[model samples]
Target: MTTANLPDLHDLRERTRQFAQARDWEQFHTPKNLAMALSVEVAELAEHFQWLQTGAATELDDGKRTAIRHELADVLLYLVQLADKMQVDLHAAAVEKMALNAIKYPADTVRGDARKYNEY
Candidate 1:
């Protein structure tokens, strides 16, 4: 779908839930399984750029880009499923984490640095 027409996170989560429910797949969608699946998908996504130099990944052709997109969708689906099963609101969790990160890595101190928060 186009960027403007993409489904919202809640809608996507609902749809993913329905898809799993319809397939009686919830038994197989435990947080551990979903997390593992998410990790695999992330690895697959990383494979696309494994040997590429900086800025090369963004130069992928349409087919490679499409593959990357599908890999990302897979990662998101598993992450959403895992969060839903754990009764977590993904958006809220992300916002809260960002807030904590902002505190841990204040711009004035962390800007242009790649060190861990503890090191900063």
Candidate 2:
């Protein structure tokens, strides 16, 4: 489907599944490999932020912003691909995890808090 016709998250996930199936990449998309790739992409993203003032980040020029965007997209694409590879429901997993986190860090007790979970 064209970008305009692209579906929402769940639908896109299904499309990702179909794409992987057609390409026969499931066998090579093991969790370990996907995780490694994700880590590498994250490092690439971090490289752009290294030693930069926090406010200076989004101030990137168009070319720099585009480059950073590409790296960010790589990280996201790998994550979605990993979800497809693992046959996991990313949306549900995200919701469930967030719920668990809310319990672990109730806002009344943790609002504006910056401590680790165990500390909280």
Best by TM-score: 1
Per-residue lDDT tens digits for candidate 1, residues 22-75, read 999989998898999999999999998776775275678788888989998999
TM-score of each model, in listed order: 0.88, 0.78
Q: Which ten residues in a row have the lowest lDDT in candidate 1?
A: 1-10
Scored by lDDT, model 2 comes in at 0.81
Off by over 4 Å in 1: 1-7, 55-58
Candidate 2, residue 22: CA error in Å? Answer: 6.5
* Candidate with best lDDT: 1
CA deviation > 4 Å runs, candidate 2: 1-7, 14-27, 55-58
Local accuracy of candidate 2 as per-residue lDDT tens digits, 1-120? 664565566566666667778999777778899899999999998888777777275667787778789999889877988887778777889999999999999989999999978985
Report RMSD for candidate 2.
Answer: 3.1
